[model samples]
Target chain A: MDLTFTPDEQAFRDEVRTWLSENAPSEPLPSGDTADGFALHLEWERKLFDARWSVVSWPREYGGREATLMEWLIFEEEYWLAGAPNRVTQNGIFLLAPTVFEFGTAEQQDRILPRMAAAEELWCQGWSEPDAGSDLAAIKSRAERDDDAGGWRIYGQKTWTTRGAFCDKLFGLFRTDPDAERHRGMTYLLVDLDAEGVTVRGVDRLDGDEGFAEVFFDGAFVPDADVLGGVNQGWSVAMSTTGSERGLTLRSPGRFMATAHRLVDLHRRCREEAAPDLRDAVARAWIQAEAYRWYTFATVTRMVDGHQPGAESSLNKIFWSELDVDMHRTALDLLGSGAELDEGAEGATDAGLWMKGYQFALSGPIYAGTNEIQRNIAAERVLGLPRK
Target chain B: MRFAFDDDQIDLRDAVRGLLADTCPPETVRTAWSNSTGRSDAAWGALADMGVVSMALPVDAGGLGLGALDWVLVLEETGRVALPEPVVETAVVGAPLLHALGCDVPAPPASIATLLDSGASLYADTAECLVVLDGDALRMVDPSTARLTAEVSVDRSRRLFAVEMAAGAGTVVATGPQARDAVAAARDRGALAAAAQLIGLAERMLATTVEYVSVRHQFGKPVGAQQALKHKLADVAVAIEFARPLVYRAAWSLDAGDPDSAVHVSMAKSQASDAAELAARHALQCHGAIGYSYECDLHLFMKRAWCLARSWGDARSHRDRVAAAVVDA
Candidate 1:
């Protein structure tokens, strides 16, 4: 029942806080999904990688600090508090990396992790297709044996590939065994975006960022070395990644807590003119963040005690995704009509940060498996409800 | 940092849960509803025999001297059965208040009331020693010496009464700043107790509904197969999941005397209140007609949930308190 961090944990927190205070950029960078923004974010990622701060929980051989999960949480809190730029290589480092570590061979880990950590290569997720958005098992993407080339030739289209236009590679499910069942026979592969017959067309997102893309593959060649886990095992492997995406890795409490603090500060600044209702909303939003933080802590504690954290991540997804939306909504409401102004508009509040954030938070529920699907998963898996 | 109870605490909780399961079933609770004092004597006596009545009292007072963290789970089990007793008041808040007030009381339990908002106290009609918070003072009043009027509660098994204690009728156990702090702590414990109980009640409701939905058939299939109902109850389950940690954390915060313990309690109460109410709502909805009637066991837990959710600061009030703490720019 103890909540206080250990002395070593405190020391690590102090060290990171001091380093972040000195090294983190004073001004926020552009969105990492756009070309110019991606270029700037690449530099930030490089800076973090060089300092071994990008992925603190990974093994030291992979350019991480080999810190504990609690310390990793500490780093996130510091990173978000420092207002650090969003990780440009998050697709590789946060989501895919865990699966790779779990399923990848030593050869694959040695080849893939260091480069991804150092920003030498960037990756994007290619899960959602136009027809296979929520029903991911219905993926039509196919990769056939091209043993002559010692790899498979992939042919299909993946839509809503976030940051795909700028990424050099992608990791996704490919139908390898056509005879297998709906959830079987898929192969999780790391595909080179520069491979022949591969095309990435950037799609503009709500915040006017080309972070979304539709990737079309017409017999693109991927090496045999890129197959993650065994063939027909992609469903389980991809489930692990989605678990991370929907769980603690994709959205740590630190980010929301920082935003909540900002919301509180904003209310303080607007105290003279803020309505009582708005004040209450700001407070409510702040509690949601705090509650999520404690929820994560309790979860981490359980995992630390050696409990398998399946399905509960679905619970986390429902909570944080909605918390992000509600918190951002409260901020925009507090800002009133001025929230509509775009960035740099003369009358825009916080450089229209709340509006931009609101638009982005809108995607939280839609992406990483829609909250609807998550609720179903939670009901069936966590609550033992009937699937039918 | 360990965020879970140790083996001893778990053992204590399990023991309390088992004891209540034997001594305080719904039949006993129904019997208590018609009894004079509305107290389950056998259940209370068995619990006291287990030393739960004095578990939180100081060691010098011939008790276990446990903290709220240890008893948090026990209080939850009490709520699970909708235990027709003031275990929260008698043990959790009262023993601590009695200790703080330096009162030389008997080894038995007493119902303590601090809200004093509605001019009524729980179990005030027949409580021998009533710990009452009047203004800036904490008092140990004899309910028999004051004007007693019974107030019927929705959950009839647990009774309430309005007390008209004369000014300075009881011994002024503590006064000024000391009394203020103890009273505030007592109030926080009350809220935390309610929150833990609400969480337990929610779990009971969700389990009952889940069991009912699985067996009851409709439209040629089990009613639980409906996604609408599944998702509704899933949200209830999720609410309970999230609300529980807040209650546990609040218990820890109070046990450690954390400065923001009040805020933690508020968060717990707010979330737990919502979880229980949501659970009750979905349980009834999923149960269809049966849950509306008194025959269905779900109403027993739901009625207790309704009563607890509003007591010791409802969800809205607690959220406002949370807002004040976090939004005080």
Candidate 2:
């Protein structure tokens, strides 16, 4: 195996590194899930889209360079290392776009991707409902045929939608056939939050940011052209989206590598106060982060050879989710008494980023098919263990 | 960049693995513990015949001229079978020392008393020469001339011994800064080799555990059906999967002579050690009572994992090295 990158890939990395260093925002943008922060984040998104860095893996016709997966990973590494603003449009770029590229009609691709890439039409996923937290199939959201209008009328609520209060539209599943099985007869729909009879109520997260929204629908209309993968096939399509997003497809190791680097910096700063055990823990966290980078390289190697990542992605999710928690926890420990300080406190360190990240990482195990479900999938699917 | 083994490396690994499967099974390993000499002639001869004993040396030295990248997988195979042969000591650590020093060290069954990993050298009593890195100088002593005291290892297949030799010993083959650098690199090689082996040992143990849990019945169902147990095994699988790529990258780093090779090696060793230790702990736990018994084959792999997990810079030591490099740098 060749672990060294080719000269061409190296050149690509250098270019990304130089470009990000020069163009990335001088100051960190506010949390993108908040309304004002989202407006500022959209400005950053506009610049990225103008430079065609919005979606490096997509086709050039869609404002992308069509870079290889390896290049995509390099871009991610540079982006995170530069401390670039969060992509407020990730739900559209990462989650919805893959399925769109796979299942959207030519008209849909032409009309949707470009604007979405430009961040002109913000998008968020409408996956979770109050009743369907873990059992996503238990969603009771319904859609009815509106024959005269040539569209579908949607009904029900989607709660805990990240940045839903700020997003212009959404993509989620809605039951289209009442008589069909629980998993079947559902259709994946892209709906506009601004449409008539729709309500978006912002909810405060643990960090006190209104980063979540509960979208309520009463006869909100979505045209037939918005249906993805086809009617009654939402289960398989949604599964494919969530499966990859939970793995290396979305959460590139670059982000964690940056976090790990920051963690090392934190340790270096706190060396005097850090104990021998804390030093070891910091080293262990950094090592785990580096290990994850190599792990991703190996995985990307297989994928480049045309191998699909299957149940093994469950292994990936289980690993990085916990690694994220550990890395953040180690940082909090290094902060000691100072860690209790919230953001903007008189003497808060690292601007309370580690504390913010620790809170966010807590949700990592709970969201995207909780680690419990992911473990079960690993046992049943990868290990061939009996499913009870 | 490609991060996978090519066909040649994969073929070489599979070949050695197949040979060991036949020549060095659990019964053969058991024999090494009670045999007249700890050395396994059949396995060592077969490996030497295939050029594996000298794989890490230069081609001019009558060796395969392979780098850590090519030989690391084969070492992992040795770990898979828990082969009683001193492949790591002789091939990984010794052959290179001899080749670099330009010494005509006696044939295949050499041993080392290295400060890097071993306080006691393995197979030293049966070795033709017991080599030691005496600071900036490399020295070797005829095992017959040296006073060798046998030591009891938790894993009996590993025949460790304390070697005591006179000041001058037999010869000082190499000296000064070059020797010092070579020894340091050799230390990393030793640790990297152990890391690869730990991956193999963990995988084998996990596989055996998986097989046992799938079949062993309890409370009117297969014991593996329990969610709690399945999650534990799943975690073991996760740890092993993540640890392996680190071993591979570390081997690549060593072959490239990267400045960060030591850091990479430490990362690999720490992760692999944790993976193997986790496997050893949970494999026995999942297998229940029988796994602890001598009659069960799980102990054979489990005990080897226990010894090897800390053999080459236990997880904490390695992690501390990593911490110093990254934290201080």
Candidate 3:
């Protein structure tokens, strides 16, 4: 197997490297929780959209470069290496957009994709509910046909909706047939967040940020045109989103590699006081990151050759989630007493980025399907183990 | 960049796997432990007939002259069955070392073997020639010339010998800069081979444990149906899958002659070792009392994994090398 990039791929990387060096964000944008911060992130998305760098792998008609999978990976590496701001529109662009491309009608694609690319209609997922965290098929959210037979009326409460407070729309799963089987009755619907009878309450995360929210829909109207795939077939469509969440779309190896490099620098800076165990931990973090990078390369190659990722995505989810937590934990251990400092504290190192990241990393295993559930999926689907 | 094996490599892997499955089954491995030499001549002859012994030797030396990456899958297959042979030492390390040294050392038809450090060498009693890296020099000595004291290893299938070579007993194959490069390359290859083998060992152990748990009943049901055992096996599966890419990447780095090949090799070795150790612990726990016994086939792979985990370099030693590369850079 060849590890060196083709000359054309190298040229593409150089092009991306040059462009990022000249035009990447100079300062960090505000967190996309508050209205002001959301506006700032939307502007950043606009800038990327104008440069056709918002979604490089998407078709050109959807405001992307229609780049190859390898090129998309290269772009991610360059973007993270350049210290680019996090994509606030990821819930729509990375998660929902792929499903839409796979299952949405042409009209839906024409009406929804461009706005998502520009972050004009930011989106959040509505899959998880208070009562249906891991047992997703047990969701009690219901959607019934309106009296006029024009659309559906949705009534449900979706919790852990990341960026829900800032999002303009949501792609939610609602049971359309009450008497049908657990997975057969669900319908995937697109609902406007500002529509009548919709309310969002922010949930304060460990870092004291409203990064997610609980969205309440009280008879919210969604036209028949907003339904994705087909009625009562949402389970299969939503599986696409879960696949994207576990696959390369949600967490790119470049982010971990960049963090790993930073950890190495920290280890070097504190080499004198760092314990032997801490040194090994730092080295292990880098090695795991490198392994992840190579694994992603193999995955992207398979995808480029027109094969879909299967149970391996479950393996990827478990691996990256654990790696993220371990890497952050190691960094905190290296920080010692300084780890307790928040970003607002005076003379905080790295503005307490590691502490903040540790908080976020804690959510990795919990969100995008819990690691326990992912492990079950891997065991049952990948290892051919019997389910209880 | 492609990070997968080519068709020829895939065929090579399948062929090696088939041969091992047919000739080097666990029963054969167990029986070999009682043999005087503790080496399975049948399996060795099969591998030799397949030209695996000379796969890494230079073309000028009447060999295939394949690179390290090409031999990775074969080494992994050998590890899967815990093949009681010095293929890793002879084919992967010694032959490459002799080829690079351009010395008139005994070739593959006459088995060659090598060792990592000075502690013990594998198959030194059976090999015609033993290649050892002494400081910056690569030395070749007749096994009969050295004091070969048989030592028992944790894995019974492997027969280890402590070699005490007298001064000037070995012919210096290469010295100075050439010797240093050859020694470094051999170390990297050795580490990579060990790492690949560990992955295979983990994979086999995990698969065997999964199969055992599927049929073993507990609390009126199969234990594999329980979340605890399933999760443990899943964790082992995750570790094995992730460690594989690192081994492949390290092999690629070595073949490419990259400057950072040493770091990649160390990382692969460390990761593979950790994965194999985890697999061994969990495999035994899941298999219960039977896996701990020699009668059960699971102990064969589990013990081999334990021995291989500390063979080329233990996890800590490899991590220390990595620390030197990244932390001390």
The sequence of per-residue lDDT tens digits that candidate 3 reaches over residues B1-329 is 98788998899889999998999988888887888877786889888888888888777777777888889999999889988888888888887788777776444556776766448888888999888777777788899999988899878878889888887778888878998877777878888998999998999999898899999998999999999998999999989988899999999888888999998999999999999999999999999998878789888888888888888788899999998988788
Q: Per-residue CA lDDT of candidate 1, range A95-203, in tens?
A: 9999989999999999999999999999999998889989999999999999899999999999999999999999999999999999999999999999899999999
* Cα RMSD, model 3: 1.4
Total clashing pairs for each candidate: 0, 0, 0
Model 3 earns a TM-score of 0.98
Runs in model 2 lying further than 4 Å from the true structure: B39-41, B105-116
Scanning candidate 3 chain B in windows of ten residues, the lowest lDDT window is B101-110
Pairs that collide, model 3: none
lDDT comparison, 1 vs 3, better candidate: 3
**lDDT of model 3 at position B226:** 94
Candidate 3, B184: how far from true, in Å? 1.3
Interface RMSD values, listed in order for every candidate: 1.3, 0.9, 0.8
Best by lDDT: 3
lDDT of 2 by residue, A1-388 (tens): 7778889889989998888888999877888877898999999999999988999889999999989999999999999999998888988998899889988899999989999999999898998998998899899999999999998999999999999999999999999999998889899999999999789999999998899999999999999999998999999999889877887766788899999889988988998987768888888888888878988998888999999889889999888999999999999999998888887787988888889889988888887889998988898899888775
- The two-chain DockQ for each candidate, comma-separated, is 0.71, 0.79, 0.86
For each candidate in turn, the TM-score is 0.98, 0.97, 0.98
Q: After superposition, how far is residue B166 of candidate 2 from its true place, in Å?
A: 2.7
Q: What would you estimate as the lDDT of candidate 3?
A: 0.88
